[model samples]
Target chain A: MLDFLSEFPSLGRRDLSALRQWIDEGFRTFSRAYGEQLEAFFNPLLRFLVWFQDLLTDAPWPLVILAIAALTWFGARSWKITGGTIVAFLLIGIFDMWEDTMATLAMISVATVLCIAIGIPLGILMARWDRAQSVITPILDVMQTIPSFVYLIPVVMLLGIGKVPGLLAVCIYAIPPIVRLTNLGIRLVDREVMEAAEAFGASYRQKLWGVQIPLALPNIFAGVNQTIMMALSMVVIASMIGVQGLGVPVLRAISNQYLALGLMNGLAIVALAIIFDRVSQTYGKRLQAYRETGRD
Target chain B: MTEEEPKVRIKSLYKIFGDTPKVALSHVQAGMSKSELLEQKGHVLGLRDINLDIPGRKIQVIMGLSGSGKSTLIRHLNRLIEPTSGEIWVDGEDVLAMNDKALRDLRRFRMSMVFQKFGLLPHRTVQENVEYGLGIQDVDQGEAAERAKKWIDRVGLAGFEGHYPGQLSGGMQQRVGLARALATDAEILLMDEAFSALDPLIRTDMQTILLELQEELHKTIIFITHDLDEALRIGDRIAILRDGEIIQASDPQDILMNPADAYITDFIKDVNRAKVVRMRSIMGPAAPAQGAPVAVSDTIEEALQKLHAAPDGCCPVMAGDEIRGTVGIDAAIQALKAPAAAGAHYS
Candidate 1:
């Protein structure tokens, strides 16, 4: 019986080599035809990202540290958080990696902002239309489940390996969580509240802005936090494509077997992650607490 | 009372829920039961042919248990739930045919709703929640704020304007809901189980507050409730629904005294009729009687109390001091013989 089953040529003996070759050839031709146009479409955004990164890195280290610490204070509303943020930034500076840290922050900021700007509307559309959700879901699933490095390959092939390709890879890797969470957030809005809004004659725009978005804020903020963390995690991988950041030190240390340098830079990355996490988590918790207990 | 025109008229309204309700509607109209429709075609008969004329400047209460389509009927007034086939007229304008802009205008300018769940926006203060309808109407912010404050105070939430709905008790949150609806000053108010979420005592207090407000405002109010007592207390006219069909619709006394069918009869079997039936129902032909007359509007309970001190155990049933008829001990005793009134506590 086993021999008979194995004798079916298309079963165990079947090979996917031909299908793989066709897919590879098709992708290569498609990219050769449309790659330039795609890059042209994204050029302005890439330029803006580069300009923003340069502006931040060129700013005085003390001023940048002061501003970040102040922003953390504003969001977290905690002296402890503000102090921690200052200490974290100062540690990066002490390790002679202040510029690299700023570069990484710039990359994460640009990627996170773009992700939110693009992801939230798509998510809202998904929430509003079943068709859009169905169409986008499988795409999001693929984007999230694939190895993060896989994103860099096509991006590099199309844009040809630089800060732009690296940033694009980071964005592709980080966007799905925000989109999924945003859709979930909007869908989770209280049905009674939406009915009340509709009953009160709220227009589509009014309902979206006044009711759904306000209630979805905590969840959306959580998504942003996750996106930022994901973007940061991609820093070292992004360095493989020549985007200069704190990850460069780590990569250099790996090849040179320099333990102290790798450990210091790695700790700096962790510090940045902790600072971003605490600030965003605190802000999200405040919103949730207000919803639960009427205290803000 | 003055004879008011109908503010909201629903003509032959039907709502069927499914992928294709128009196909299922024929079976429903041909007397298929709700369960039969659900079982046979996978379509839920949300409402059967419902016809009603809600009078202007009066409270029209639609009462039923859950799944009776009372809430669905109220939603149809605002066109929140589109009917499978029907016509709804609000203020003599065809609401069903209004375009989106006109419908929005109708909602913003003509009607406001109070919800059973309060539905206060959690992110906003009580004051902001009250200001919502005005904001949607594009009222000037200052004027909107002034009006919102007035209604907030009128609903007896003067100092809690800054508090959120989460900070308030159920009754207090409903007051905020009341304030929000009233702040819009929409001529027609749709209250869907507005007090059903409150405790019994709080619900009674809310009913009193509504009646008092209605006395002064005289806004056209369509209220939905499952509680019979609340319906009787607040409704000038009542419509009772069962399984998506109207069993009977009449004044409180008519409903209590002569139920239209067995279902309605069983419904009123537990009701205290003395408090609902008026002196006019049991009064005899006009005749010379002993003591000060009791008003025709007085409940039978009041007439009995008035007869207690009457010299001849008789009194005139007076409408504004014009004697309509006389009520003696015989008629009073007969009225008291109502099945549920004999030993039931008035409260």
Candidate 2:
């Protein structure tokens, strides 16, 4: 009895190995059959990603910096944040990491946009139905908690090592916060307010766009900020699959033991994260200014 | 009063709140009590056999304490809360039988409601909130804005149109709520405890505003309240509900003089009868009195004030140009006292 207890009965090694072999072979067959169609399905996304990266890198450096400064100013509405962002970008440029910074910025932006475009509707669906929530919540849990390398194998197997697979890997990691936050935000809308909309004969579409979505904006913006941060963190990991960015230098530095190279690229990523977080947070706060002010 | 059809009619209305409402409804119909139903079947009896006919263009007040289901009953008029069993007829159309499109039209074009919590969209300005109902109906943007502005001005919120509801006082937010409802120009206005959240002074002011608007608009209004004073002040016809059942419904003066049950008597026991009892209710047969005439419309309190200066203790009550009866100080005092005990339930 003691021996059995200590050993802990489990699947036999032969059975476990056979199960693993079966899964690997099944996945290989599926990929071999669907690989061409899957590539065609993602061609437009690939073209868009390439075009966006080219736009960021091929543009004159001054124009790019000015555009980022203007976007920061528009979002934060604060001169301090805009000035800090400008200085951060200039520092990256002076350190000769401008090209890599731009490439990473493009990648993170596209990933975030794609996540929101897909995740928000899925989140809304979850908020509408308990069945959908129960089903999707577990899948999102796996996406969020599973090791990045585990999913990387399947994604790489399906799409091969390139920008698309890397983008897919980053999105898998970054999308959960957005989807969860959006579901929470929409579900948290006041019941009385929604009833008022219905009492006035608002259609389903009207209630969503006019009342629910507007009220949920601050929370949705929070989700976006979180998604951007998670995407940025995945940059180095994503670079291992051939996606180009500041992650490339960091990866090189890791393999070659070059301290300066790793430090500069890592700091550039940190600077980018700070600028995105501050601008988005300030904008979110601005959206709820009405709630903060005292009665007139 | 001229004989005319009521604008809204309800018959055999019942509401049961639970997963198996139809089953619970059968038990309630078979005479199960409210608490008994809740205890035995885990179902709440929301309203039981509600039948009422609301006349056109009048303020019909439904008075009840919290949990009396006055809000639930009013929502049935617009079908916001579907009934377990009932028939609702508004202006000759069957409300319960309406399909989705018809119900939408009914709510959009015929009825509008003002909520107790002032459910103005917090993200929207007062102007945008007021325009919401019209926007839902697909009205022209410029036209909707102009109409919304008119109501915003009408409700005394013109200057605050650009402000968000969160930046306003409770009274101001309710004004926005009122303006939003009225801007739709729906003939039926349902006010579910619309003034209950305001301070007493603000509540009184809002009551006066509603009365003044009703005088001109003559919209068919259903007002819900827990305060007897508010019901007496504004209700053309008052219905008193308790435990999901209406114990009494009649003219305001009739309810004050002749309460239908012990619960109603207890409900009105603390009310200052002099303020609510009209001279018309207490006046005697048409007889010449040795004092100045008082308007039949005056309350007992107002008549007493007038009698204080009269040489004689009695005064003639005039309906218009002619005396309808006389009311003496003794009769006025008698009217102020509570009715004789009608039930042994209350100590």
Candidate 3:
């Protein structure tokens, strides 16, 4: 593949060596920086996360299982989803990956929260300003296309290794969809609504928070939903940094040729994605419904 | 004319669109017409030296064709689009000089607008949409809700409190739009062809609603429309605008009877004089005491109704129960038969 790529008329040897050198330099820099600064504080962040993970264990397996079942029941507005939710978790328990699954869930929850925090405001800004949109759109395009493995280097330099850095990497990889979708949602709000707000003596701020943001919620939620799925996909790549969970099992399995372990971990990921996806999509639809009916 | 001064005043208002507006407009003022201004430079003078004085509580309608600057004129009242060179005073306050706070305060407290496309907040319920203006001023939730409910009820949207705009028909949405503006209690209402977007039947319904509201409140209104029928129906004082100038402004009766210019005459030509024109104005001599006579105040619709019920299409249009002139069977028949037949001889 490398030889085929190099055969391109524009290709050159110096470019390849320079790329190799850059990759080598980035890895060493990250290794040194992360070990020195993150070795202590990173441990506590992980412990705090793991402590939060332990708090979930306090709910008891049956209650936790029932909550998931309840979610799917109310969420899809269908009993079929409720049955599927129960079965998916059953598969995780059968595979003996419940604890690791919970850890992955905690990391995902945190990253998803961060994505919403960052993405919605960016989307709002982009919607309101043409110059801001012109500046942000190309960058978002690059962020979405850049591979998950490629992001770990800079994230490790900026925040360094372990839970925080891994989480940051996941955020970078996942947040673009939310921002783009949010911008799309807000831009799609009818021109009349904005004009109405203005004519009603609404300040710009009032129009934004009161009209634009609420109207754009469904699109933002879809973006958030996609972001969660992206974050989950990045979880395995993030684990290659000193982060751990179901991703660790998958990484270990991949390295040691443990097919059963890899297969089981991958199945756990699929289950988790389904569970989160159905729930998020259900809420997104609910918001659209509420917007239509003007109900709470 | 009133003992109290006019509520709104504009003097020599000109809105020129260009980077070098002053330069472009200066050339035009030096004896060049608007077309010449556009030709000499890439400058289009949207509004040119318009002067108007709107009396308090008057429903003054500005009628014009599309691209004739009626929309632009209405927008200027609220500073939605600032005039290029002009002064507008609202309630003795210099509108052009107001800071952002003052302008916004004026909008929230004293003025509001109804756009043609309802412009309802799609994400809000009809009730919440009405509450939006109050919310902008940070009114308490209870007060806003109460006011919104009152206005919504007034506009006859009481049961539709929770319905979004998409669920409502074009006319219903316009009712919500009118309610939203009225809820603000702004003394001046600027309507930019407020009912123009609806079907003819629905448009009539909205115009009826507007008439009822005006009867009750009598807020100073600035209405813009291209439809002359609508313009005549609602305007207490009609201002015929042509290419940014008010060609004729007078009581509707006066304008219908005697238009100010040849352009205005041409515009009013199709407006059946028999319908809007009084028999007293069109008829010259009183009828001898033998033939039937139509009433002086009889609208052409009523005259036609009478004619339709009579043995022949003719109805002697009477003034004050006295025969002014015999509108012979031939005349009524001609009016009924062809569009061109009526009003030409009268004019």
Candidate 4:
């Protein structure tokens, strides 16, 4: 077809040989320009994430448990959270799995905090603009639905294995719940209430800060709580990326077919999960109740 | 519109909410009334071009059934909803022409609103809700607190300042809302059925509070309500609206005694017009003064009670302690007898 077109009067001198040559050269340059590096770009990051994981597994279990106990005591300021924290403290201390438990808690904390810090602002931006919401919502969905292992592959490729990379992957895996919830919360402010603020001479910023955002606090807190739980869930998966803590020991015990080690580390992870869940849930409940009481 | 000038001069204001408000407005300016422009653009004509002159320091009720544009009209005064076209000369300045900041300043400083649902901030306590606007105005905490305390007490919520709105009854919530609007101390008050959310008894209680507040402060008020009884009971001048147009804007007695059309007549028909219409409607013109004078505010029931106790079978309608007219004893009795005979349910 190319040779026939070249012979036609209207066709401007099409040449198959030259075209083939151009295609070959273009393919060569394209491969040269865009081919993957032999060295995994994520190796350093993956290594760092694994170090983070190791820190979790290698840290003194007693110290890790004590830190969590202190955190809940300060934040919740209630007997229930304090009691739960103590139970978490004793469970690790008594089971003689204190080191692994501490490691798990550390990993989960970093993952959850990072998730929240990024998630909340993104949610606020989505709430503030429909275009941003449309663009970001699909990305959040992708983050939420894709298998956890997919995250590790890319992290390992770009940054190498580490505690940081796993934590980063864990955050990416868990943050959507918070962002989606935050956006929904802000959007759900009563239309009449918004109108009242405007009628009362409140500026756009005033309405957002004074009325809409404040009303949305309970919902946003719920999102944050959900994020915490999700981040906790991702801790185990993240351990695959060289994350330390209970996951590392469990994985080690599993690979070596040491049933007792696996069971003990798993139990320690469960304890950490319960502590994280209770504290986050209690704080979120406190926020909701305070709002109701204040409004009432 | 007078040279002496009223506080708010709303002339041919229009608010059509749909598709390209700017484009709709430009089309309206090309020689079309609000409804015509709305029809031309196939938009919901929320507010027809309404020209109203609200006087300073008077309680003017904008009465209408649902979807009658009473709320829409009042909302325009504060620019909570901007008018598509037409001029709102607020104290001789075109309100629609004010820039964003100036308009907000106007709304915050000069016009404040109370909603039917008691639009208190749900995250705030009664005290905070009352202080919300004051805070927005940059009033110092102490002063805002002081002002909030004063109005909260004035609205008879003296002990409930610390309580949240959800803890308060519907009436108390409305009171908090009123106190919030009052705390702002804005001269123009736009009340969109502020008392309607309360039960009947609580509504009456809030009504009395509002009457007292108006009497004391004499703030110019634009009150919107679908309840005709509320309008007749509270309004200094009532504008009867139907289908986004004012049918009549007159004194309550004028609206009750001589309603504008069949619709308004039906609206006032079931109302015990005799009870709502004062003795002035039944009384003879100024008679020779002989005894103590009854103020125009005295109700027929009150008049009946006062006349029954009096030896004389007559009561004089008094203004500033002078007899303006005489409501005869026979006339009073007949006025009393007629409603009772009509199964009017005057009570």
Candidate 5:
């Protein structure tokens, strides 16, 4: 009895190893059977990412700079932000990081678009039904709290270290904020306001598009901003699995102990993040301009 | 007073609020009190055995304090809150039997509501907000805008059409709310404490505007309020509710002259009777009198003012072109001085 209490009863090491092996074999078999089909399903996304990256890299530097400045101006309507963005791009170009920066930008943009497209609907579903919220919330928790490398192993096993798998990993990392915020934003809409829409005979689609979506825009934009930041932060980890970006050189610097190379690429990433954050936040604030001006 | 058909009829309506409403409803139907049901079954009784027939082209006021279910009762007309069991007939059609599409159509085209909180879309400008009801019905955009502009002008909000609701005062927001509800051209206007959020001065101004609009439009209006003064001011008929049950429902003068019970008497105890008691209630049978004639519709205060200025202390109460009765100073004084607890003596 004393020996048993001291050791504690547990599964034997051989049994645990066998159980792990069994799970590993099951996943490998599953991936072997469905890998080609899954790859085919993601072909369009792969093609789109390649085309976007090529477009950014092949376009004249001046033209790209001008387009980004115009977009910044349109979104933020601030001369300071537009000027700062132009200067940042010029600096990145001077540092000979233009090609990698464009690649990273393309990846971040596509990741953001995909996350919004999927996350918003899921968030809306969660807001509308308690059961959907109950089920999805825990899944989101697992996706968020689980270490990036843990999911990377299975993702790489299935897709075998390419852009599509890397993109999937970034999306999984960045999607939770958008979904959670969208649900919260929609739920936070005034109850009386929703009732008024209902009393006016607004159908479900009408209420969603006209009232709920418009009112929730600021929150959705916040989610989008967070998603972009998270996706940018994942660039280096994503590059570990054969994705190309500034992250590639950063990874090289890390492995070779080259401090200057890592710092340059890291600063480029930080600049991009600031530009995205400011522009999106400014646009979100403008959407709620009415709220700021009212007396009571 | 005419024998015309009622525009909206509610029969034996009951509303129990809880997870298991049907079970709670059984207890309420069997004469369980509201508090008892709430304590024992954890269910709220929202409304109980409500029966009312609202006449067309008049303001029907549902009056009660907070939590008395006056708001809940008005929502039943538009089916905003579904009854636990009852039937609501609007224009002789069964409202409760409508499918989703039919219900939407009914709300979109036949009934429009103004909210107490002035539920204007914060994202929309006043013009767009007013045009919302029209837009929902898939009306042509230009025509909807035109109609919306007309109402914006009518509600005295023409110059402020571009301003957002947040920029407006409470009174102005409600004007936008009124404009939005009226823009649909629906026949029934359901105002759920529409002016209760405004200051007293703004509330009276809104009341006057509503009355002025009702005079020209002659739409069937259901107005809900807690203030007895507001009910007496605008209601063609008033129903006083207490604890989810209607204690009394009648013409304002009838309620003033003969309260149904102690609860109603308490509700009207502080009301200034001189303002609400009309000459028609205190007038004697058709008889000749010496002073200048006062309209039967005039309040006792107005009649007294005229009677005091006349050489004689009596006045003839005129109903249209004919004198229906006479009112003396002594009777007017008695009417004004009568205690609410002893209101039955007047009847």
Candidate 6:
């Protein structure tokens, strides 16, 4: 059996260098053709991110803290949660991580919005058509299973090293959860309910907007939460391509082997994650409770 | 079919489930068994050559056990389940020939349905759920709200309008389902086991509500149920289905007095005869001599109660105050006796 295995040989030994060269050449040509237009398309989004960052950092610290407290109160709907959110923000201030945190926040916000804008419709398409599901499912699997660092190579090749490339790479890494959740949510809607809608003669558009989306909101929000978390996780990795944030300090600490700086930045990231996580998860739970009241 | 044309007419309806249904239909028509068709051809015979005429403004009850295609047959009337091959006529218009838009129009304006599980939109309030049909029909916002509110009140769910379906009890949710259907003001109302999810007491209350509303509205209702008693109580004409075929179609009194075959006989064996059997069914030819009078529509139990009050132990059966025939105490008592169970249970 061992002799026969050697006789069959390994798949790696059969690779053609010419085939690899041709594929790389083809990709380069395609990238050359589409790169400028893609960058132009992303210009508005990039501008929005810059504007958001300025807004967050330029505001008076007291007003920004008050606004954060208000948003926290709205999202978690508890005084304890609002107090926790304020403490988390105050810790960033004490650590002197405020400006870097704002940059990370802006980058994550842009990446999340982009993911939702792209992921939801694609997810709906997957739910609507078997063919679309079949086509996109494998791609999503690859995106999720591959190492996040591996995406940087492709992003560098296409758009080069910058905040835009870093943002795109983070979005690519973060989008799968929202897409998968959206598709699952729509598919999970009760079949009898869908039939009832059809029997009542609802148009396809009406059925989608009126029934499906509203029912799927809780799941979709869960997806958004997961996307935001994933985007935040990509922070330090994204900083490798010159995206500035708390990740920059983390990257600097890593290169210099500075323990205090690395630990402080890492803890700041965890703090941000906890605040975002609590608010979003609480809101999602509230929506689910609102939808299913008799259960309790 | 008597004085007025039927509100719905179905002819030669055949529904087979599979991609190659036409091929499977041929095998089914050629007398292949349902299991044999499934095993050999991978297709299920959902409905077989069903013919029925549902009279206008009368409650036409379709009763059968689960998988008997009773639900399947009713769904065909609304084109919710497209038949493999069939003709459906609603109000003398060919339903099968209608395009998608026309079919939508038919569902929106001419027919409404109540679902078994109370298919209320969980995200919507009860008022919004009740208003769904009217909204779909493009009724004006204010007018639709008014009509929905009225039906909601009629269904005895006046204060629950602000509540969600998930917040309401099953019976209340079903009332919202009823209100939704009624608010459309559609001529035909199709209720597919609309009360099956409720508790027994609530189910009876819903039945009373439906019957009382039917008295006033007179909408052509096609009610599907597995309960024989419910069928007898509400149905003007009852059609029994088994294995995707109509076993019998007749008046409820006829079904109770003379079941078509062993299958239908078995279905009605456990039924309370005094409650189901009517005076008209037990009455003999009209006699010149009569004492008290009972309505022809009166049940055997009522007729017996009436006969007990009569000194001679006999009462004339009246059809709207006109004497048609007389039912004796002996005949009413005889009809009240339950028939012996004589058939093996079908698998």
Q: Per the 3 Å backbone cut-off, how many clashing residue pairs does candidate 5 have?
A: 0
Compose the digit string of candidate 2's lDDT tens values, residues B266-332.
8888899988899999999977577778999899888887676667788999988988998898899
| Distance from true location, Cα of B210 in model 2, Å | 0.5
Grade the docking of candidate 2: medium
* DockQ scores of all models, one per candidate: 0.58, 0.66, 0.27, 0.47, 0.79, 0.62
Please provide, for model 1 over B81-155, each residue's C-alpha lDDT reduced to its tens digit, 9 standing for 90 to 100. Answer: 999998899878999899999999999989999999988898899999999999999999999999999999998
Q: Tell me which of candidates 1 and 5 scores higher on TM-score.
A: 5
Misplaced by over 4 Å in model 2 are: A1-4, B308-312
Whole-model lDDT per candidate: 0.88, 0.93, 0.81, 0.77, 0.93, 0.89
Interface RMSD of 3: 4.2
Task: For model 6, report DockQ.
Answer: 0.62
Question: Per-residue lDDT for A101-139 in model 6, tens only?
Answer: 988988988898899999999999999998999999999
What TM-score does model 6 achieve against the real structure? 0.95
* Per-prediction interface RMSD in Å: 2.8, 2.0, 4.2, 2.6, 1.1, 1.7
Reference-based TM-score of each model: 0.94, 0.97, 0.84, 0.83, 0.97, 0.95
**Which sections of candidate 4 miss by over 4 Å?**
A1-67, A94-96, A290-296, B1-3, B20-42, B282-284, B287-294, B304-316, B326-347
Error of 5 at A206 (Å): 0.5
Error of 4 at A212 (Å): 2.9
- lDDT (tens digit, per residue) of candidate 3 on B1-347: 33888899988999888889998878767867778777878888788888998888989999999878889988888888888898999999899999988888988888988988888777678888888888887889999999999999998888999888878888898999898889888999989899999999999999999999999999999999999989888888888888777878897767776667667767776776556654444444544433445786666555655656556545566657656665544454444322222244322
Enumerate the chain B TM-scores of all models: 0.94, 0.97, 0.83, 0.85, 0.96, 0.95
In model 3, what are the clashing residue pairs, if there are any?
A: B293-B316, B294-B316, B294-B317, B294-B318
Clashing pairs in 6: none
- Compared with the true structure, what per-residue lDDT tens digits does model 4 show for residues B1-347? 54567778888776777888767756655656656765677766666668788888888999898888888888778777777777888878988779988998998888889999877787788899999999889999999999999999998889988887888888888888889998998988999988887788888887888898889899999999989888888899898887677878899877665656667766776776446657776778876534346677666766777666556667778877666788766776665432222323322
lDDT by residue for model 5 (B116-210), tens: 99988999999999999999999999999999999999999889989999899999999999999999999999999999999999999999999
Model 3 residue runs over 4 Å out of place are A1-48, A57-59, A70-77, A290-296, B1-3, B31-40, B279-347
Model 5 TM-score on a 0 to 1 scale:
0.97
